[model samples]
Target: MASTQQSRILRVGLLQDGRILEERHLRRPGDLTVGRDAKSTLVLPLSEDLPARFTVFEYRANQYNLVFSAGMKGRVHLGSSDVDFEALRADGMAMQRGHQYVLPLQESARGLVELDGDLSLFFQFVPPPPAAEKPQLPPDLRGGLWRTMDRVFFGILAASLLLHFSGAAIIIASEPPPEPELSLDELPDRFARVLIPPKPEEPKPRAAETAQAAAATEEKPQSNDAQDKPAEATRPANAQEAAARRAEVVKKVEGKGLLKILGSSGSGGGGAFADVLGGSTGGGEIAAALAGAGGVGIATEASVGATGPRGGGTGNVAGIGELGTSGAGKVDLGSSKKEVEVSGRVTSSTPEVESSDVDREALARYVKVRLKAIQNCYEKELKRNPSLKGKVMVRFSILPSGRTGDIEIEENTLGNDAVGSCIRTVIRSWVFPFKPDDEVPVAYPFVFSPAG
Candidate 1:
């Protein structure tokens, strides 16, 4: 029975606050120590109240014994009843050694020992676990790479490489040879026509010459007419001869009915049918006779030389001089000015600001007002990487003149240098409202998040 009990495994576990912390299985008879020391078999967390080391289970004389100090307390399960340490002491079942208590355990015993009412050690006897089987490779894959690799895969790979190389070689062999290089002398002769410079274009004729050519063509007929006459007779010899020639030309024109059609001799009621032909004094008589005979009556006619209204006669229609003025005054078009409204919003996390000389709140307000520029920097990058969102801390100095200087990114959690650089540039351009007594050092953080 003792051999059989030792053959079975002794499983001991340490638990704290109902949670298992460490567990071990002992196959051979031995002492099990539990404590907060590193050298202990079952080491626990370091605690000032816990002892450095203590034995909880000891195997001797082919029997296991449970051990505990006097202050320790717990219960044990043996046979058919549950027994506490105090009960065991009162029944004289536990052996006292100075301040330690020892209780002999049976092969079937399982119990819990509580240390400081917080740490618990549970021991029980369990069957030994079966041995684990070792993994083994196949016989064919046990040697070198040549034997281990799949034959079909290796063949396919080798064939593919061979086919690629052969195809490349065939292409190289079939390629056409490059053309022979030409010398400079041969090149110039082969492309002589292309290399020759073209001749300069002829300039177009001027406007004056073109006009003279057209005039000469038009005067060709006049020259021909002059040629028909004797050169000496082309012009009249004297004034009387010139007048005589003019009169002859006029007489020939009148003989052709030109003077009669023009009413030059008052034969056709004067030329162009003037009502007062030749300024005749019988105008009223003609008008009255036409009226009495039911013919069209002609109004009193003024002489062509008259400039004003004639006595008892309707004058020529008045000539239009200048346009008359309109009575309307200038119009009022009101104001031409226009008003435009622009609106937008920029969202950002509250800036973590620090300043020595300047008021921290005022500095924060100044940063808040300019957050739009910083937001623009972040949004510009956000368009490229939509998932970009993080914190960027900036450090700058407020000069005595209210201008910013020494602006730089102190910390950047966004991992993007562009945003940090852009923000630094923007902050450098800012001017605080209040001038500091001395240079004020400031560090501000701005958090960015993508808007929904």
Candidate 2:
């Protein structure tokens, strides 16, 4: 529906040479005239076929009365239909707001106004809305006596509430504090005894056997040179010599198969003592074996002790100082390399593909739907002056998410900004079906003509 406010004013929208010339407004109810004369209300450019005055409009009784001058030769129209003056005379045809009327002159002097040039007119009317009535009330509420009584009763009730709360505060402030349930003097004897601490007991003396062992080590006889040098003097010498000697012994024993010797010596194997003694009663070799196993320089003492003791220095010794296990003397390797084997299988996969095509027919259908929403913007203006015609080219991009953006007018020749902007806004809101991983660009053209 057309707006009622549009009916309140008469608008003359003019177009000359395919461009907008001017727009005129008439808000008052009076006579309007258009012609070539200086005395006319609206003077046009010079033309011989046009009389001194060509047209007249009278606004009376909220209706416009239109008529042509006596000598004018051209025809006037509401859209494409010819005006029926006879029917207008019979009942006075009414002109509605938002409707367009056109006039084409046959003669022109200024090339600006051609013989087929059009003078277009559109109207806007706004009738005032009706007024509303005031509401009525009872006479009792309006009188002064009841109003005074209402105020006095409300004041009395407020004062009573204040007094009642003030009395409650006074009663709460006058109450006494609570008494204790028990006193500290009533506690029992066990609680008092916890304050005292008990005395500690003395430690027992050491055993006599342990005291004898300590004294024997302390009283052992020492040589004159050893007693003078002190125990700290022997530490460095022992460390260097022990490390070198132990390494030499380990190399010799490992090359001669110490594990095989130990195993055969304990078993009933032939030549077990032959391997240890090398099939000869060699005292020097026996002395060397005793010194290596004991980790001490007592080879001569061991030979003398063996000659006296139960044929025993070469016999199986259950415990040899630190030789409890074979692995105990093995060299440490910090980090060792390890080899791991792993095997795996791989499988191939195929993904689905989608079609990507620029369908002009599909795009045309979408543009047809969009055109219905914006064509009226140009139609209402184009209907008045039929000569104005041009094209609007809009460039836009469709995002992967199926939304339109970056809309811009590449070209516009519609002669007015409103028509171009209306079409641009509709183009920016267009949505197409989503294309996977693709962005589409579009440059669409729209043409407008009086005939269209």
Candidate 3:
């Protein structure tokens, strides 16, 4: 009973006459010792004649028990012990230690415990009030929720500011870019535009005046110089002489083996031959006449009479080849003549070793390999500016000694000069097949492209 009583709460009240004088809510019932001592639950005045430690009250099942020690000095009275109060007021009581006093019959009442003379302490009994049912928040939890809301609000604000700044920076950086400047090599179109002048507009002529001028020119009399002269006409005697002179010219022409007549013109002819053999004749006219007459040789026989020391006739004209003209001094015009050999000189301007004579696959392979080494230049330039992509046409000459020279940048779409120069330097260091006859010119194209 004592162990169970020590765990429950006890409410003690001290009252005098009717009203409460003092109240205490006790958590530890075992530690409650009322006395004149300073550490007791209810310390009385030293002159009260109470024990150094007085009585204690313990709680059980919603009721309180007053327990007194054997050494208690005061006489603690029970409910309405010496009072003739009303029946309702005769409720609470007090007792000596080592003796248990049940509470008063009434729900609330007081007892007078006499000390000395008229001085006494009154004890009261009262039940604890019902606990309230309203819900409440702890201080720690409320403060934590407020702190969390504050952090979330600040985080959202910071995020919004960062996004706003980022978008602004993007807009600022995205302004229209500057237009590209023209390169030095791009001046050809400008030069052509400036240099080529527009054709002059001609003045329109009056149609009536142009027609009158044409009619006047047509009405003018034509001159006939050939009919005005009689000496220009050919006669039989002059025709014979003209034939002899034409024969001499044919002999010299045949001697060079350049032209050959197919057939003989009749030596005694008198019509077209008469005109051909007449005085007025030119090299072009004679050729035309001979071609028309079928006089060019084709297996016809003729004899060439050579003048020996005795001046004797070597052969008759009829026995000579057809190429030999029938004349007093007959010569063999069909005989083969030796052409002079002019060594060490190229008569034609064309290269002795043309592109067809070169091994194109081998040359292409070599160039492909060299292109890899030279690519470093454009690679570095493209690294700096990836937009660079174009063609480069390099024209270079391979000397007869197999060394590359006369390197030229025929076309370069790349804006940088260093790229072309670097490529030229690499090409100059290249060696090719030795050609003693002619220098080989190589035209190579390079295309540069950057990867995405």
Sort the candidates on TM-score, descending order.
1, 3, 2
Compute the lDDT of residue 138 as modeled in candidate 2: 77
Give Cα-based local distance difference scores for all models. Answer: 0.75, 0.53, 0.57
- lDDT measured at residue 298 in model 2 versus the true structure, 0 to 100: 33
Candidate 3 has a TM-score of 0.22
Any idea what lDDT model 2 has? 0.53
Question: lDDT by residue for model 2 over 108-153, one digit each (tens)?
Answer: 1011112224643322233433335777577766666646677877
Per-residue CA lDDT of model 1 for 1-452, tens digit only, reads: 68778578789998989999888888777999988888788987777777999888887788888888777789999899889888988787999878888898877889998875578888888998877788878976678887778999999999999999999999988968899998767776548667886698999999999999999999999999888788767789999998678667755765456434643435444333233333443433322223334543333325234534434465564333433766989786976776432222344444444445677777777778777888888878877777787788777888889999788788888899999999888987887887878777777777787775
Please provide TM-scores, in order, for all candidate models, with all chains considered together: 0.31, 0.21, 0.22
Question: For candidate 3, lDDT tens digit of each residue in 1-452?
Answer: 34433444455555445556566766544445666789887765566466687555554455555454333234333454534222212343343223444332233334545444444455543344556688868876666654767787888999999999999999999978898887767667768667786788999999999999998777654335545455555443677798777777776775353243322343434333433344222323444555556544432123121332123434343322535555587688978888533211101111222455455566676676566666776776776676777777778877777788698998888787888999888888888765545677777777777655
- Report clashes for each candidate as comma-separated counts: 0, 9, 20
Top-TM-score structure, candidate number? 1
Indicate the residue-level lDDT of 386 in model 2: 57
Candidate 3 lDDT for residue 349 = 16
